[model samples]
Target: MSSQPTSNAPVLHVQGLGFGFPGHSLFQDWSADFPAGLSLIQGGDGTGKTSLLRLFAGETAPQAGSVTLLGMDAVRQPAEYRAQVFWRDPRAPWPDTLTPLTWVEQLPAHHPRWSGEAWRAHVAGFGLAMHLHKPMYQLSSGSQRKVLLAAALASGAVLTLLDEPLAALDKPSISYLLQALEAEARASRWPGRAVLVAHYDALGDLPWCARIAL
Candidate 1:
């Protein structure tokens, strides 16, 4: 993993965050500061790990408090904030008719750091190159997840939030992701980049910069 010295400055800062649905509450007065590198968000079902990630990604606004990334208020400057983040809900609805290649081709416009070459490499690493031409509906769950994973890794966003990333992935793909993330953590250009992944199960034997449980 990354042997580079980590800075104390928080790449992502959350203050008195709160969120809830009709009758269920997720977080209340929750606060934390995430430094650069990989951070695992561990929790059981209903613990709101996913909710917290969504909040950080600007996909869902907090009911109270605020989220700051690189000194920018997520709520006040959502477009700018989101531009620096890469998040894709695994269960998010997709255009069933679109191929993976088509979907990935549009990512560069949204992610300035996007690398088409990196995307292709990740696709090959995940054994997804062969499936890129197939429609989303025709691909298996594992393949679909790989497509998204490839995009996330290639986007090179300052902050990347991935929920249930290991789910539906094969052993080889999982290993590839782990190794890729480790390399990302070590990169000099991505010094302030932070990757947050939510996992329900133990991240046993996996290299992580840190872990936080909800």
Candidate 2:
């Protein structure tokens, strides 16, 4: 579970990348490489942090340049590339009405690495008390965020692309998540990388954080 991206190439490589919406450019000529630790994407509101993360996640096509993970081209090998990364966004949709436990149970059993008990413990760690049978939509926004966080942990992706990961979370939940992430980083001999976009500076004490402010 090392945080390395599985190749000599950077975990994330961006070269001459640019994106625009209507009359404004969100980002342009942005070239950077994310190495084997947590890289924080920091910016004020409307600075395109989410857009850039979406571009990296292969959810949105960048207007120019290239986004590559390991050695695979992002746009060319989208499915393979995306499978290695997990994206968590608040605006993203959830299962229509699945309960937390049922949703986790429905995942294909082929992924032996992600166990139900482990996810259950994770959810509990975040102070979410709902049983798996409870409807997800019935939970508060913060509680829903907890569910999504646990789901991301269970997904077992090498690269973690988190958008506002700390939003709507309490202090204990935040501490719990940071510990979980630290353990995730330690589990791998050379785990993939994690890129977190957040306004909070709580990441200051994280083991290794490279900051890039826009």
Candidate 3:
């Protein structure tokens, strides 16, 4: 809805964040600012890329420090803060047995900026027309991930977090996703939205707003 020129200010701000599993520490005194537009969180396996995204999404609270989005405090105003963020872990199992169409239909209530037009466009672009009616568990791996990928693009949440976006995607689907990200980089798509992708490598020569090497 907002077509204003992108500001250099951080859409997502983090400070003094810390986290770790039982035996290993992932982050200590980690701090970073993520501006709106396409950005990459690049690292190899076991580098905590996904965990970092979880922290940004507020799904996994940091052991210390703070996170804020668009000046919305993720700690004190969690519901409001998280509503503006769109994040889904592709590695986890989905307990929702609904069809992709049904699942996406619920986005508007949770995501104030959810865009139906963008959803329709991405669904078509990803060639997920037929799979829309099928239960997510019934779809192929590629199709299942495509459903989530399309939702991530169309959710219109202030911050969209994508982990390993290229996984399970076919060649054509990958091409479509690349085009979408390129458009975002050009300021021609998903305006006013900050998207962070956690992956091992850059997908293309995108003019990323930020590049954090986890």
RMSD of each: 3.6, 3.1, 2.3
Clashes of each: 0, 11, 0
Q: What is the lDDT of residue 173 in candidate 2?
A: 90
Residue lDDT tens for model 3, 83-175? 788998887776567899788988899887788988899999999998888878888888988999999888877899999999999999999
lDDT of 3 at 103: 88
Q: After superposition, how far is residue 144 of candidate 3 from its true place, in Å?
A: 0.8
What would the TM-score be for candidate 2 when compared with the true structure?
A: 0.85
Residue 19, candidate 2: Cα error in Å is: 0.3
User: Which pairs clash (backbone N, Cα, C closer than 3 Å) in model 3?
Assistant: none
lDDT over C-alpha atoms for residue 183 of model 1? 74
lDDT for each residue of candidate 2 in 1-214, tens digit (9 for 90 to 100): 2234454557788999989899998888999887766677777789888888888888898889998877667798887777667675776667777887777675535233455665777978987665556787777788888887887776665566777878889899988988887776565533555545455354656655457787
Model 3's alpha-carbon lDDT is 0.85
Model 1 spans with C-alpha error above 4 angstroms: 1-6
Residue-level lDDT tens digits of model 1 in 22-134? 99988899998888888889999899988899999998999999998887788998988888899988888788789998888888998877888888889889998789899
| TM-score of each prediction | 0.92, 0.85, 0.93
